[model samples]
Every structure is written in C-alpha cells, then in structure tokens.
Target: MSTAKDPGKGAEKAHGKPSAKTPAKPAEGLPAKILSKILPPAEAPKEPGEEEGEVPHRETAPAEHGPGPDLRRLTEIARALNSEPELRHLLDLILDRIVDITGAERAFLILRNPEGKLEVRASRSLDREEVKKPTAKVSRSILVQAEKSGRPVLTTNATQDPRFAGSDSVAYMKLRAVVCIPMIMRGRSVGLLYLDHRFEEGAFQGVDLGLLEAFGAQAAIALENARLLQENRVRQAELERSKEKVEELNRVLREKVRRQSAELDQVKQVLRERHGEMKLKYAYPEMIGRSRRHLDLLRLLDRVIDTQVTVLIHGESGSGKELVARAIHYQGARKDAPFVSENCSAIPETLLESELFGYMRGAFTGADRDRKGLFEQASGGTLFLDEIGDMPPEMQSKLLRVLESGKVRPVGGKDLISVNVRVLAASHQDLRKLVEAGRFREDLFYRLAVITVEVPPLRDRREDVPLLVERFLDAFAAESGGPRREVAEEAMALLSDYDWPGNVRELRNEVFRACALSEKVILTEILSPQIRERAVPRSLPARLDDRPLKDLVRDSVEFVERRAIQEALARTQWVKTETARILGISRPTLDAKIQQYGLEKQG
Candidate 1:
C-alpha cells in the first residue's frame, strides 16, 4: 500500500506506477501554472495494464463498470466553485461537487474555527440532498490523522485496515472506502474534506484519490477567498453606521450654537434698555417736582421717550406740556436732530398752510424763494404742534394724511416730500369732546393720540408748591440782580392754601410781582389781594345754645375726624397703605372712613 501525500505538495503514484491521466479537455478560469499542478498533461504515456481511454482498477477493489473521470466536467466544476464568493453557499457547493465526483454515499466539508476547533461546515448525500447530524456521520479519527500529517488519508476498507480499525466511527458504522483530504493553504491545514461509502470496500480507488487531491487544492483557494469577502462586508456595514452617528452629532452641535447666540443677543438688548432708563433718571434736572403724580408722569415719559410713536399731550393751558415735549426731544435718540414748534391757533387760517408746508417761489403773493416748512425742518427729529385741538377741520385732514403716509405735499409744490419726523401734539381742550361734537375728525384724533401723556395742573400736586416757590424766588433774584427775597411763613401758608386758578403761570407772575415790590422779606401785604383774602381766620360759631351738649360734642368729634382723614389722605397722596399707617388704623377702617366722609382724590 502506498502512503497518501499532501494534496497541495503533489499527487502520489498508486501500486508503484504513476496514476493514469484522465483524458479530457483542458481546464479554464485558473492560471496555466496552477492548472498544470492540478491536471495531468493529455499526451502522457499510458500504463501497461491500462487500455486507452479506460481507468485502471486497483487489486484491493473490484473492477468497476463506471466510465473514467471526465476532465471537461472537472474544469467546469472548478470554474463554478471559484465563481461563488459567499462562504455558506460555497461550502455546500464544495460538498455537493465532491459527492458527485467520488460517488461516495455522503460527503462532509469540515473547517477549523477561529479557536482551531473542527466543525462540519457542510454535508451532502449522493442523492444531492443535505445530510443532518453531519458530525455523527464523520470519522473524527480520520480527520485528526489528515490534519496532523498535513496529508490525505485513504482507506479502501476502513473497518479492516489496521490504520483505522480501532476508530469508533469506523467500527460502529462499518465504514468502507473512506477518504479524508486535508485542505491546505500557505503550507497550513485550514480544514479537511471527508467522504465515505458504507456498503462497498472499493467505492473509492487510487484514480479517485488522485482526482480528489487535485480538486482539493482548487477548493481550498475558493474557501479562503469566500471567507475574506464575508469579513469585508461585515466591516463595511460597521463603517456606514459610524458615519451616520457623526453627522447626527454635528447637527445637534449646530442647533446648540444657534440657541446660545440668540440668548446672547437677548441679554445685550436688556442691558441697552437698562442703560437708557438710567440716563432718563438723572439726566433731566428741570423736570422739577417729587409729587407721586409728577413721578408717574416721568415714568410714562421714560417708557415712550425711546419709541417713535406719536404722543398727544393733554393738559390745561400754562401747565407746561411744551416743557414735557422738549424733555422728550432732547433726551431721546433723536436728540441730535432739529426741534421745530408751531401753534395751530396762533397762525391764521389763510396763512397756516404756507407756514406748515412751504410754498414754491412764484405761487404766492409775496413769494421770493422756496422755503422748507416745519415738517421738513423737523426731519429726523421732533415736531411739537401746540393747540392741535384748535386746528381747522380742513387742515386737520391734511395733517392726518401726512402723518399716515410719512410724506407731505407743500402749499404749491407738486412733489410730495418725505419727512422722518416724530410728531408730538398738545391741546388744553379735550379732543375727545371736540370729536364727539364733530369739531374734530375722529380718525385724526385717534391717529394723533397713539400715546397720550396727561400733564397734571399745578393745583393737583399742591405739595410741589413750596419747591416751585423757591425756584421762582431764585429766578427773580438772578434776573433783577438783587438779594434773593424770602416769603414770610404766613404768606407762604396763604399761597399754599389758596388754589391757584391760572396754575403755575399765575403763581410765577404773582411771585415776580411780590419779589419786585418787597425790600428784604415778602409778606401777605405784598401778595395778591385774592391770595390775602384766604388768610382771614374763620370765625367760630357765635352760639352753641341751639344744640344739646352731647349733640354738640358729637358734631365737633365728627368734624375733627373728617379733617384728620382728609389731611392724612392728602399727605399720603391718596395711597391707602400710607394713609392707614399714619392714622394708626387698618386699611379696611381707612377705606370706610374715606367713603363715609365722601373724600375723593382730586385731579
């Protein structure tokens, strides 16, 4: 018996002669050098006992009636095996082809795992159906011998052969015609090809072993190629998943940056608003008056000062509405622009249009050259229109159009001029009443009164009277270049007690007159007669005889209570909390007293 050699090394001779070459066409799809190693040349000399075109049968096995191995079929099978790249499918293909070529009852392709353990990768029967429980069908002893020696193990009759007689699988299954070929790659056994026939002793011959050894070499290469391709596919899938994760992270980062930028811009805007508020609080010293009403007006002015909304100032004549307008113009964003003022009542109806919107040079009686009007002059600044309630109905319509369109047509000019002016209108008369009586256009009134600022008259904030008096006294001294005159206590009391009907203007005029006449101290004698009349002490009731003692006492108590509550209300500026605190009473009790005494806050 001849020993089996490694299929990858070379094919060995059987029975002391070279194995007869299978006569068929040349192979394809493999390199010629590799094909030469796997297939015998067609022109080789025939064996002595072998006839032309006939396979030689060995002495240990009976002669077969089957034809010789077909070279063309083997080449086709090699091409088919190499073309398959998927590992699982290629393994089944290898086993199926082995069963067909060797005429074995069953075939198994066993491979080594990463841990170097033998595993049955595929199994096929002669019927071309898959065999289950392939591990039980394979001979473990044969597989070990083939792998260790790195050679093919062939037994014509495994049960009788001493080499495999002690194998449990061979004894139990009575295996015969067994062959185990080691699939070697790069001089290392990667796995083994196992085939067996259970019934016949010479089912596989020397000719079959030679053909299988050659086929095994091609199969090993195919198996290695398939395993590498599968690994590459798994790695490619992992890379795609990683790329998507990176893109998602970048998107989240961009969104976070955008939100942070917006929040920063909001913080900057808040800081700017706070800065503007600080400027309003300390910048205007002439706003004058610490009364709650005056403070409330200042707050309202601060709110509207930075905005470009039209403001309508509502107050009685000489209450200083124009002063409030000037404060807004000078202390606001448009402080660098011009401030133009006009009195709608002062200009006559015939000349008002030309005064407000300038006429073209040759269009009027005394026209000399084109002149810009108040609206044009006040561009990019503030325009104060005093006594707007007295504006004629026709002129009011034109003013409303200009204010809405932001463009005004001059008296005789054909083109409409655009003006970026912020308008502030003032009126002592109530525009609401004028609108109701049809003396003013309702639409125009609403348009002008986008924001309304009410300037309190001097009488409403009587607590400011002392401060105003001191200011006026200082002004008179500065103007006359004389020693500053001081008013007597009684005279100041009389001035505070008497309500000034003509408001601050009348008060200033009276102070000026007193300062002019007095030498060092201003007294009641120098004050106006109307103010002096209030200085006369009120006389007590001449007779208390008509009412009972208890009744009279009750009446006096009520009068004192009423006076006390009234004084408290005035001192606290009608703020119930302060009024109650000063009177040492609860808020509910103070409210009750105020209601009972018919005490109401005066405007």
Candidate 2:
C-alpha cells in the first residue's frame, strides 16, 4: 500500500495548449522514505526464459547466513498468516517474501480492481508519492499479456521497446527492464506477483522464473486466508447482532432485571452452546437399527468415553460406519474442533489428492489459486476417511507419508506443512485380502489399524432389533415434524426376525418408507412386506416345520444374500459400499453378487 505518486512528467506545452506531451507530474509528491517503510522489500523481476535459481533478500542475509535460519523465518511466515488481519498488510508481507525469495529488483501484487484494471495493491519499488497518484484506466495491457502467456515477459531494454515507452503504466512506474509472471488458479489468472530489473538490465533466467512461481503459491494461500478471515469476521458480527436482539426479547418476556439470574444464565449458556452446534450439520445419514445390536453399540460408546485410545468400528454398510464415526467425534475430546469426514470412495482417484491435500496456484494446468484441502481443515481434530481400502494405490503411498511425517504438502506446493490431528479410518473390506491382492498397501493398513472397532451386522446382532425398531420410530417421528407413529408388534417382530442383509442402513430406509406410506399410527403388514421373509438357519426352520434340513439351509443363504443386496442397494441408493454394508458383506462380495444376480440398475 505504498503512497508513491507517478514519476513521469509531461513536457511543458507551448501557449498552454494540449499537445502530444508526456503526462504532468502532480504538485505534491509522496516521499520514497514513507513508501519503502510501508511496502515490503521485494525480489528483482526476472526476464523471459530465465533460469530456475532462487532469490534471497538482502535484509534476510544478516539474520540467515545459514539455511536453517532462513527456513525458520519461512515457518514464521506460515504462523503469521494464521493471525494476520489487514489484506494490505498480508499482501505486503507476501510480495516482500516473493521478492526476497527470488532476488528481484522490485516486486508488487497487482490485483484486478473492480473496474477490471490492474492496480498496485502493494508495491516495494515505488516511493509513497508515486503510489499515491491515481493510475490511468488502461484497458487490458501487457499485464494481461503476461497472464495469458503463463511465463515471464522479459524486457532487456524497456524504453527502447515499442510497447514500453508508449505504455502509460510502464512509463508511470518507470520500468527499465521487467520480468512478470501471472498468478494463476483454477484455469484463470487472478493477478500478478512478479519482479523486474530497474537497477541492472538483462532478461531474467529460467531458474529465477521458477523460483518466483514457488513464491506465487505461498502468496495465493496468504491472500485466500485474508479474504476468508474478513468474511468470517463479517458473519460473526451479524450473528452477534442477531444474538443481542434475541437476548433483548428474552429479557422482556421473562421480565427479569438482574445482572445474571440463575435460570436466565442457564438458558443463555444453552443458547451460547447451540450457536456452535449450528455451524456443523451432520452430513452422514441416520442408521435404522433400534434393535439389541445398537444397545451393545451404546454400551461400547459409554465404555470408551474415558480413554482417548483410537477405536476402530468395523461394520457392514447399513451398519452405520458414519453414525459410529459421528458418535466418536461429537462425544470425543476434540469435539470443539472440526470433524471432517471424507468418503474415500466417493470422489475419483485423480481428484482425491487435490481434494484431500489441496493445491497451489498454477500447480497444474487449471489451478487458479491455492485451495485449502480437507486434511488442513480437519487439523486438531478427527479426520474420518471412510472406505479407506478403496483409495488408489498412489494415494495410499501419499497417505502413508502423511501418517509417517505427520505433515502434508499440498498439490503443487513448495513447502511441507506439519499438522496435529487424529485419523479415524474405516473400511468394511478386509485389508489383509487387499494387501494379498496388491490392491491395498500393507504399510498403510498397519498404520491405520492401530485401533480397530468392528461394527457387527444386523443379522449377527439380532437381539438388538427390537430396540432399533423403537429407536427408529421415534427418530423418524421427530424428523417428520408431524404426529408420531408406532409400529405394530407383529410387524416389529417380523423386522427383528428378518435377516438384515443391508444391516442398519437398510433398516432406516424401510422405516422411512413405512412412515411415508402408512397414514395410521401403527405401521402395518403392507409397510413390512419387503422385510417379511426373514433369513434363518435352514435347520431351525426345518425343526419348526418338520421339513428337510439341507434344502432349508440352501434356501436361507440365497434369501439372506438377496435381502442384503436389495437393502444395501436401497440404503446407498445404489452406491457400492452401502449395498455391501447392508448385507454385512465386503464390497467385493457385494459386487460379485450384484453381477451374478444382474442386480445393477438398468441403463
């Protein structure tokens, strides 16, 4: 935010008439001393086709005669970004670091102003007076040219060049020799942060150009943080205003006139607590079991509360990996921090890295700027990586590295950032099998398996079904925000006895369907038909009916498999893992059954 004025002066006109003369210098000039102090010291700009050598700041040399000290300063820069406020100040720090990192003659962050003109938001080269002067409204200029090119636009002799002498921006800024690189993100150039040579002349080498690009990434992140912080502050102010109004209404209604009455204070505290919960909404859907199985789960949850040891909950799809993950996160020690959950199988392999680790400005072809990835967002709390077995092999390698180093390097990033967080990974698949097949990494498996808690399927935990049914009835009733409903005892018995192939997940959808379809208070036979034929041991059914045992066993397995697949398909709405979980089966097993039965949705 230098306040330097334009340096170029127009020649005196004869008879005070307008002529083809240079622009006139304003009367009051901002001093270089003021500009230099405010503007960050920058690296000199490199010429086109420059070498890839890093630039070091002169001021930094005294403090960092060694590499260790220089790196420490960069770490300090990262910590600084987390707390820094003013956009101008941050931009100044960033631009200065870029200059220091690249050894540029001068550096500046030229942001696209609202009018679509590039304005010097922060400049290190100009005096306060030169920066203070208003810039001409030049339509897309060489600045745009440099952006489109995606490489440094080098000029050995600026004044001699046809474009330089006539350009008002160049003339005003007094560009002698310049090298500019566009700051790019997600397929578009946002602005420019580059250096040019005003002290010495010659095109910048390739090495110098590469170094500047590295700085460009750091700059984008710092800029993004500043913008987000400002937005968050505005939102916070709005919330505070709303809260005050609510408090005023409460004060009037209660007619309480005390500094802090006990009842009022309790209500106020509850209100304060609710504000935090409002930020995070459950992305994971509800599970369907109110049966004896869930009673065991609740007991386990109660048992695990005191210790911070990692617990791995293994379960089939409808078995509720996410519900368990949520319970662990919300009731766990790091509940105050983010509970960032990522379904590893949901996104494509190619995009997963960028989604998980984030990317830098111009790291790839379309990267417009730096983006914060999930791992960074989930720091200081639990990161739930669902279906971890489904992650790609290459990504598994990256994941292992992060686990080992406790650090992440964003895609196209220059520095490795350390993070403190807990990792809670869940997969219904057998990791040992994946390793045997060379599909999943063994190293990653052990690293993630330090504590594993397997969630049993609905069929295994049949004793819990009655409880689950009751639980779902209430939960569904609350969700409807309508009159509560009940399940007929006969229908409830059928649900508990039926082998739940789709596990807890399938049970939920069934309840939802029954609730929506049934108008009466008690859900009847029509709503429970899909679950009527319960899977049981053939011998058990035979014993009841005095029938053949072998045939019953064969019939039972087929019926169970079919029900599980159907329920899974229903819960996941055709997603692979959901179907697998519903059946208390592995993804591969479910896929095989789907293919065998041709159960896939028709095109």
Candidate 3:
C-alpha cells in the first residue's frame, strides 16, 4: 500500500499567504492543527466483489458517478448556505459541505482581499497549529487551469502531471488527485474552492466536479448578496449619525435666533423709552432748578440714575419725592420697562399686600381676574413705594424677602413669581427713627436705602420760588386762556417772606388760584388769606371809633388803594406802563386809581 503526499507542507510565507507561483497549499499555524484534529481523512469506496487485500482498479471506474446521491447532498448543502447571511459563517458552511460532499481528504477556501490578492479565508482537514501558520503555494499548473478556463480543474495524478511533475512544491509534498473550482460572481472569478485527496489517484470524479461547480455558482451569488446587504447597513448607520448631528445643529441655531430676537425687542423698547425721556426732560425742565441745593440733589441723581441701586427719598410730603424717583427711573438702564408707583399710606393695609404682590383670580372676594402686582408690573423697571415708612411691619418683612430674592409670592397664591424691579422708596418720616421705634424693619430700611436722596423743601430753596411761580403762572394762564398776571411788589415781598408750610405743592395751588382770579396782576388781596392777613400787623386798629362798619371798610379800602398806586408809580419812575404792571392793574385802571387818589409821581 502507498501513502499519498501531504500538500500542506508545501512552500509558504511566515504569515500564511502564498506567493504568486503556487496556490491551494495546506492550512498552517494553530488553525491547521485544530482543523486536522476535527476533520477525519476521507475513506475510499470498496470495489464490488473485491477481496479485502486487493487494490481498487480506478482506471475501470466510470468517468462520472450517477447524479442521485450527488443531487441529494447538493440540495442539503444549498439549503444550509441559503439560510446564512454573514459572509464568514457562509464561507465556513460552504467549506464544510465541500469536504463532506466530495469525500476529499482536505479542503480550504481562498478569496480576493481589498488589495486584489488571494488570501486563505477558511480551511478544514489540517493540524490546528498548521492552520495558524502561513499559507503554502500550490503547483502553478493548477492555478492556470482554474483561472484560464474560469472553470473547475481536476487532476487524477498531480505528481505525474507534466505541467507540475518537476515542481518542488508537488515533488516534496507528493501531492496528487487535486480539484480546483473557481467561485464566480457576475461572470468573474472572486475566489477559488480547492479540495484534494492524497491516497486515491482518482478521488474526484465528473459528478463531484459538476456538483461543486454548481455549488460555487450559487455560493458566489449568496456571498455577494450578503456583502451588499452588509454594506447597505453600514451606509445607513452613517446616514443616521449624520442626521442626528444636523438636528443638534438646528436646535443650537434656533436657540441663537431666539436669543437674538429677544435682544432686538429690548433694543426697540429702549429706543422708545429714550424718546419718552426726551419728552419728560423738556416737559419737566422747571423741576431742574438753578438753586445750589437743587443742583446738589441733581448731582446725586446723576451718580445713581444709571444703576439698579435702591433709593430712599427723604423730604417733606409735598417736596417732589415722586418727581425725583421718576427722574432716576427714566434715566436708568431699565428705562424701557414700566415705572409703577404705589403709596403705602394711600392704600388700606388690608389691600396693600394684594396691590403690591398681585392675586389669583379666586384668591379672595371681589377678585374678578388675575392681577399683576406693582412689583411684577414693574419688572425690569422701577417700583416707587411712596410713604414706605408707613407700610405695615408684616409687609416690610415681606418686602425685605422680595428685595433679597427678587421674587414675590402673590397674596393667596402658592407660587413665587420672579421679578426684576428696582425699588425707589420715599418717606417723610425718618426711617432710622422708625427702625429704632420698631415700626419699620431694620433690614428693610437698609435694603431700601442703598442710596438716600433728600429733596429740599420749597422754603429751603427760596431761590426756586420765582422760577416755580413763573412756571405755574404760565401753566395756569395757558390752561384758562386768561391774561398772564404779574405779582405786585408788596405781594411778591409778602410771598417771599412767608415760610411755606405746604412746600411746593401748596405754592403751586396758590399760584394757580391767584393766576385764575387776578385781573392782570397778583395783588396782596389776591393771595391766600394766610399770606394776606400775615402781611398786615395785628396791632393795627380793628375799627376806628366803631363808626358804621361799612363806611370804615370803604375808607380803609380807598386808603390802601391810594397807597398802592403811589408806591407802584415811584418804583416805575412814574412810567404809566411800568406803574400799571407793578400795581397788577391795567393802564386805564392805574390812571383812574391815580386820579381818584390825587397821587403824584415821585422824583
């Protein structure tokens, strides 16, 4: 008995790749050893009626085996191959079928890599360790037959074949009886399917070659389908990632756009506010006095106007604390927002909390709708709390919380609403005194008095009196369409001497009344009785001799009128127009009074 040559020991590179000359060598490395252990050698068929010791007569066997068994085996292998989707798993299934169906001693698969070189991808029937080593080159003659014809090539005796008889690979390994089948897809060879028998001279017949060639065709199509599907899945995954990135970018862009839009709205609001401030500056120009005290107050305003610091104004009740608060708010950064004012003393204590902190629609009786409090309404702006010292102690504590947290809990509401309001408080009562008295919260006093502005009373800034008088005169005259009135020297002197207890607000009312009622000039009698009566000395006789009251009143009126004419004429240097203006009487009236009183011009 003769042993067949082992083709696995043929020439190979260290890394299991065959050189250009030979292909279809045995598997190498650990994989080869593993395959050898798992894959048993092929058993040859026994000849009919042959004794056990007799050699089989291969030359007498038919060129082709009948198709019945081959067809059945091919069907089973086809089903297995068709069910597989993965390329590696499919290749393994194909290699197994080739060995089992062909009854070959060893088999392996080689495919073209990305670099267009044939690489051993799978193997069977070799030592597992050998399978791990480098691939060995086969006789050059076999590659030529498979590649040239794009068909399966069979060798009944590879060692004696003229094309590879002297080849070192075949001679050394004693290889024989090999078959090489080309795996074709789209009419082109992608790889080779190889199987060989070492002992049997004609181990592979026509029927075996036919079955393998058909299997290779189907395997090629299946492998290509699996590869295309896998490629599509990868491309789809990449597209999904790209889509997610685009969505993220869109979200960022939308947020940026929204923020920019909000900023633009703020800019527009600021421009409108600036326009309003320009109007206010012109409308209230008289409020800006030339007096030193007023200038000092304005300077302090300039320092704190553009900031968000709280301001507590200390002044007499009618000394224009609200005016100062308005000036500061209209000049500040939050000028574009609302300016809301609430007089703590004006609102009832029961209602002050709801008015300052708002209320839910159903929170209490008469709450017909939800309402925003002064703080919320004044968000991003100023909230002027006038007479803040009069606020209830409980409210002061709540106000302190609002200042610290910038949040307000509405009356009868559960949630706290955020607000960005600048508080400007005013009080006639000294907050320090109130704090010491425990009438006001100490923390609240400090919170509201980050800056203190003292508005001088009208008495303190008498220089502003003339200016205020002129403004009020013009305003009243314009409103009533009456002739403008001038103050007589005596009446002006009377006004200048009196300390105004009601401050500027009282002065304005008096001026409006005098302007409306006076003929052409404000005289002593046209002034408030307080001013007129104060002008007269109390020691003067109430009535001389108690003579008929009417006659005495008439004589006194005449005496006063005559004296007023003489004084006016002397001051004007006896100019009729000058005298008429000084006396607050028309030129004709002055002339009539001058003639009736027998008055003469002084030198």
Instruction: Estimate TM-scores for all models.
Output: 0.45, 0.41, 0.43
**lDDT tens per residue, model 1, 377-455:** 9999999999999899999989999988999888888999999999999999999999999999999999999999999
lDDT of 3 at 202: 69
**Candidate 1 accuracy as TM-score:** 0.45
The predicted structure with the larger TM-score, 1 or 2, is 1
lDDT of 2 by residue, 1-603 (tens): 000111111111111232243322211222222122112223223334545552221111011122223334444555565456778678777766665555566666687876986787776643321223323312234566677766445565455667555676766655655656666554456678656666665534322333344344445556676877888988999999999999998888676555347668646644543343322222223444322234346656655644555555566777778778777777777889999989999999989999999999999899998998888998888888998889999999999999889899999998998887778888888788889999998888888776677676776555456556667777888988876667665465466567677877687778777878777545446555556655332212223244367545644565465556655675676888766666677887666565433343411
Error of 3 at 561 (Å): 30
Total clashes, candidate 1? Answer: 0
lDDT comparing candidate 2 with the true structure: 0.60
Instruction: Rank by TM-score, highest first.
Output: 1, 3, 2
Candidate lDDT values, in order: 0.75, 0.60, 0.69
lDDT for residue 588 in candidate 2, whole number 0-100: 75
Least well predicted 10-residue stretch by lDDT in candidate 1: 58-67
Full-model lDDT, candidate 1 = 0.75
| Best of the candidates, lDDT | 1
